[model samples]
Target chain A: MYRLTGVTKRYRRGDETVDALSGVDLVIEGGSQLVIQGPAGGGKTTLLQMLGGLDRPTEGSVELDGTDLARLPEPRLTRIRSESIGFVFRTVNLIPALTALENVETALVPLGLAAAQRRQQAAEALESVGLAEHRDGLPGELSGGQRQRVAVARALVKRPKVLLADEPTGDLDEDARDEVMSLLEGLWRAHGLTFVVVTHDSAIARRAPRLATVRKGRVAVRERGPAR
Target chain B: MFFTYLRRELRCHAKAALAVALGLALGIGLVITVSSVASGMRQAQGRVLQSRYGLGTDLTVTKAATPPTRGSTPTFDFAGQSGSSARGDDLVTVQGSRSLDASVVSAVTGQSGVADAAGGLSLRVVKADRRFTQGQARQGGDATGVINGQHGFGGYGGVTAGQSGGGTAGQGGGSRFDADDYRAYGVDVSRPDIGPLTSARITSGTGFSAAQADGRVAVVDSGYARRNNLAVGRSFTVSGSTFKIIGVAAASADPAAEVYLPLHQAQALANATGKVSTVYVRATDAQHIGTARSAIQKNIPGTDVTTSAELAAAVSGSLTTAANLATNAGRWLSLAALAVAFLAAGLSTSSAVGRRVREFGTLRTLGWSSGRVVRQVMGEALVNALVGGALGIALGLAAAYAVSCVSPTLTAQVADAPGSGGLDQGGKAVGDVLHIALTAPVSAATLAVAVALAVGGGLVAGGCGGWRAARLRPADALRPADALRPAA
Candidate 1:
């Protein structure tokens, strides 16, 4: 579960102040899938970053599983991210040098898993995403869809309480995007994972059971729909 | 984890690692090479002075006889202008009449810890040929015949005969020879324990016997014999008295190109009966050298005693003044090594850190503590330094060996001899040259210098990188791919 009460984030741009997030109040129940749909600068990525405890708000409070993220020290916040939050980036889909399996294993490094168990878990994570044959292939050697699948495997390998994906399919084609979205939904259903995807695709946004639209650094709309 | 990271970093930055290693190798290699040469040369010079000047023993004593003092009265020119001229003072004035008898020297020999004793009569001898005037000849020349008989001449005519022939001569010639004079006086040649007068290497024959020791036999140095064409088994008459040449001795630091003979024979030949100018005494062991010296001085009364080590030190001090010019000349090489090492580390580390700025920014955004990041970077630097230092040490030692092999003059300077044949076999083990003769472990001081350079380089790198990473806004780091903007 995550909650943000009147959260505000401001940046000093020389003489003017730019509000990245202003007076934002939101909440999500456990095991729920949410998509924040917005344009490039509509603060959707900012909201996702705050929910994952990667950044602190200047005002108001962000609570993750009832713990205030703004009050946590940096190391503790890192621990929270390590144990409770998994991130999927659009560009850095996986570390370029590491294989798909190793990319998954990297998420387990902070978890203090044995090498053998980490390897097994990483292989299983890749298999779950139908990338078992490509487990040892580096991100650079993989197709765009495969890279996105590896990123999804890496996100799910840690078995975190929440998964934050910032434009997970932004670089993929329409067909590859559907496959990536399907893989994400499959993992979400199989493991009961809470997903927050920041995407500009309204079609992908409509698939989520709950959708929030961000405009001008504020949540402008929220709607519920059947899971697709 | 540390090693893993180190290995990864090294693999990724192979060029930077190699650059650092090469810098360290050259720097430390030069240090070891130069230090080895310097230490080796010092030891070599020390050995030459010690062996030639009788520096093996601990004590020596000369009879207390005041040197002649210059008169205060000024000399007058033809104009009757009375003034002191630089040449007016006779630099070679001889004085002191009180001489120690052989018995007194023998008494010093009887003291505890006294290993051997030698009595010497020092006098300036004028050469007959004047080809080499003012040459010093030791009263006895018998020992010279036993070692390098080719160099010793028997009689006074034999000296001229040997000189004219300029080759090996017939035995028992008993000819009056024209060899140079100016000899150092010592006890019988059979005594090997005498301080400061021990024969380093016998070029021709055995030392003098008691009969020849008390007789007219003498041992001349190789330098004097070579110059005068003296040979063994020849007799040379001095002052109308014929003396046999038994052996020829090599010249060392003994009285600046002098010859050697039995003390009594020299005393008899000099016509200064019952006079002893100096005495050589050796201590039984190093520890008792001082005690023996003090006891001899006390017994002799009014005599100044010195040790062979003290004499060697005196000679070394004099020689160091001349050699200081050479040592100072090599300092520029050391400065160059330092400069190369410093610059290499600076450039390599700066470039490496510059490339990793984005990675460091990501780590900082991921909540890595500043201290942790600093430690990680410094750890990488330490790894580089240690590896580089190890390579440097190996290369330096090899360079030192190569230098020694290439330059025999350097070996001679280090070993204190021409051949250095015995030096190879003399110490505990061969090629153990590094430990005693060349570079000792204490010479690892170069490693510390290297590490210091690396640390300084790492700090600069880390500081620049950390400053750049810390200036990044967290929002930019966490933004979506399309939304994220590069930092100003």
Candidate 2:
């Protein structure tokens, strides 16, 4: 479960101050899939970052599971991010230097899991995302769709409570986007984990259980979508 | 896992580490070689100095420069002086000339620290009035008996530099030779306790007997005998005194006295009895040398009192120049090398850290602390220093070997004068030839310092470079290298 009360974000560009998000509040229950749709520079990524606790809210409070994320210190915030949230960024965010299996295992290390258990869990996560055959393959060796699948596996390997995706389909072709979306939906349905995806794509908005349209640092409209 | 990351980065940037290692090797190698050579030369020179100055003579007491006094200066106006009987006190000392007088000699002999004392008047052969008449035909006097040549233990020939020429007549086949210039060394050969002739070696004929020393019997070096075309038992007639060549001992290159005689006879010969140019003193115990030195100096004011150590220091004047070069120039050069090494190491490590900013950022994201990051960087720098140190030591040894190859040893020239008791005045160095050795005096302490310098330098440089890298935030991982760096 997550809650946001009048979350506002501001950034400095040289001498000029720009509003990134302003006076926007939203809440979603656990095990629901929410998609935030907006044009470029429309505060969707900023809102997602605020929800993931990567960046603090400028003038509001963001709470997850009854704990305020903005008030927590950096170490505790880092602990929250490591244990509760998994990030899947836009460009198929897999470290080029590591294999798919290692990239998944990298997320498990903060959990204090031993090496053998981490390897087995990482292999299972890769299998769930249909990337078990590509476990030993590097990001450079994998196709765009396979790389995105690897990112999904890494994000879910820790079995975090919330999965944050920022324009997951932004850099992928139609076929790859379909594959990554289907994988996310299947994992969310099976594990009953919260999934928040931010994208400009209409197909992702139509597929999620809820859709919020953001414009000019505020959400213009909120509506219920088809079943997740 | 940390090393795995480090190893990957190292493989990606192998050239950087190599450059650092090479730079350090040059600096450390130079310091090791220079210090080893300088230290080795000092050890060799010490041995040579000990051997040059002979044994048993604990301390030497010589005449110091006379301090200027009112009316000490003498003016010889022939018209005013012709009628004035030449009083012994009237003879003023020569300018820049240092000689022992009767009072100084007697006072030195009476000192409590003096176990025994003997005097010698070192005289040079300034002029020769030869009467060489082939074989049996003697022009000036009768032919003296031929004394066969023999080898006797000879030491530094007392080459007295101040007096021109002086001596007394030998009571043999010839008459007395008298002149203020005709000279022979008068030593107290009668007393073996402090005699200058105690360490003397004769290469040709016999040494003087106790009776002969009181007489005008003389011992000459082989070189002197060859130069004068005289042999043992031949009559050397000079200043109308016939000195029968009682013996021909081995000669120094330059000798203060060609012949040895009794101390009293030499004082009698020089027309100045109870006076000597040099006196050899023996202490009752080795530990009393310093006491003897202080006593002699205190008793005889304006005298150069020298211990055996002082004599050794005086004999090693030339090496002092080499020592200065090794000390001032060698140390400065090593300092310069250290500076260059520090800069090279610092700059290279700084650059390496800058290039890996993103790598550090990723590690932080992976739950690694800033402390862990810093330690990794320092570890790499330490490894580089260790590699360089070993290479440097090897190179330094090679350098020493090369130096030894060029000149195995260089002769150290020491000149002993009659007045100073440097027994060998031939400019001959007495001990094992002075040479540079690779391991003569192993520079363990200096080597330790060299290693510490390298490691300490590397650690400082690494810490500096690492501090900037460790402070990097995880946000650094967001920017790709190309975006952060402008197109070259």
Candidate 3:
């Protein structure tokens, strides 16, 4: 469960100020899948970053499970990200130096898992995304779709309570995009994970149980649909 | 965990570690070499002073003051009696010329703190062949003719031809013979109370007996006999008097060079009567030197008095300037080693840090505090320094032992010198082995200094890397490293 009350994020660009998100108030219950749809500069990524405890909102509060992530110390927030939140980025998703399996194992490092168990869990996570055979391959050696799948595996390896994906299918072909979306949805449905996906893809938006379209710095529209 | 990290660091930068080790080794080597040499020289000076010259004594007074400039010999004026006049040279020139003055000597010897006393004489003499007219034939030759013929013959002989007489040619061609005149006054050699001649070594025959010491028998130096082609059991005539050579003693070719004979015989030979130049008083302890000096100054007046330590210091001080230059030269070389070590530590640490920026960044992001990162880097540096230092100490000690072994003079000097306990003395070979072992720990100090420099250098490198990493935003850090370009 997460809540944001009057959350505002701003950035200083030399002499000028830029508002990435402002006056945003929203809430999502536990075990819900939410899609944030917006074109470039719609502050979707900024909103997701703030919600994932990777960055703090400039004003108001973003709370997760009744704990205000905005007010937590940076170290504590990093620990929360490692323990409770997993992220899938559009580009630079997996650490290039590590194989798909090692990238997944990296996430479990913060969890204090023994090396053998971490490797086993990483393997299972890769298998879940149908990438078990390619687990030993590096990101540079994988296809665009395969790399995205590896990213998803790394995020899910820790079994985090919330999964945040920003343009997870941005770089993949349409067919590969569908397969990745299907895998994400299957994991969300089977594990009852809270999924917050930031994307401009209408097909992804249509598939989510709930959708919100962001314009400028505010949420302009919301829609509900069947989970399947 | 610390060691694991250090091992990884060293493995990653193997070349740099080797360079550092080599540099440190050189520093250690230099320190060991210089220290050993200085130690050896100091030891040598001490041994020469102690063994060859009975260096531990107070006042060595002679009738003549130390050469070139002479002091007034002490005069004795009996209270309520006439002043006594004795030839300065006659009184102390020969070993026992002043024996009859036992009444006056006993009066002075009875003084408090006197301990024990004796008198002797010293002189220089020339050894030449004695040519005689056995069957009433004309026989005559100058000192130079006799000296040249003796030298040309290469052995003692009765006569030879083409020998030139005394002149500059004589001075250049023949060796000058010198002798020591000594005497025991009213003292029995068998008496423990008598202060015996402490530093004499008789290579053959025996030292003077109380009775024989008063006779014309004399002990010549081994070098003196060898140079003069004289042998023990042979007789030689000096000043028309023949004296048999009874013993040959080892003699120091220093200021104390001389042949030993009874003072009475020496005085008679020199044709001086009732005269003595020196009075040797052996005190009970070193503390009595000053009291004896003051009493003698009061009773005899103007007598120069010195302690054994003072004598040793004075004698050693005369040679210390050269020794000090040698010691300082060694120290300067050691300083150069330190400089080289510093450079090596710096270059290696810098190269290592330059290659590990990414690892450092990972550590920072992994919640390893900045202080811990610095410590790990410094620990790696310390490990390198220690290895190099240990090797250097071994090398240095080995060198010292080798040098001592090759030179007996050096070994004796080291053995006899005060404050030479640290020197390797198990002969030359054992000393060489022990030198390396002993110097190893000392070389460790040099390594420690190098390690400290390396750690400091590492901190500087770490500080620069830390500043760069600290400036990056977390989002930037997590972004693709290539995409997260460094800020200009």
The TM-score values for the models, in the order shown, are: 0.62, 0.60, 0.52
Candidate 3 docking category?
incorrect
**The best candidate in terms of lDDT:** 2
Model 1 ranges off by over 4 Å: A226-228, B1-5, B48-177, B181-343, B360-379, B408-488
Q: Flag the better candidate by lDDT, 1 or 3.
A: 1
Can you tell me the CAPRI class of model 1?
acceptable
Q: What lDDT tens digits, residue by residue, belong to model 1 across residues B390-460? A: 67667767776675666443222212111111123334111111111222232456456545654554454
Candidate 2 C-alpha lDDT tens digits along A103-130: 7887776667888898899999999888
Candidate 1 chain A weakest lDDT stretch, 10 residues: A90-99
Among all windows of 10 consecutive residues in model 2 chain B, the one with the lowest summed lDDT is: B169-178
Report the alpha-carbon TM-score of model 2 versus the true structure.
Answer: 0.60
Evaluate model 1: give its lDDT: 0.61
Model 2, position B481, has a per-residue lDDT of 39
What does candidate 2's lDDT look like per residue over B1-488, in tens digits?
44544564455456878788778888888888778777866655554443332236677666763444687544322222311322122222211234577566557768877777766565433332111111122233323333222222221112212211232212212111111232356666665445445545677778776676567667766766787788987876433455777777665422345566666666664455666676667787887887888888776777777676665555444455566577689889988997898788878887877877765654454444566678878878877777777777777778866766664444444444325332334533222223323232337897797789779767866877787777665543434433221111
Model 1 error, position A152 (Å): 2.9
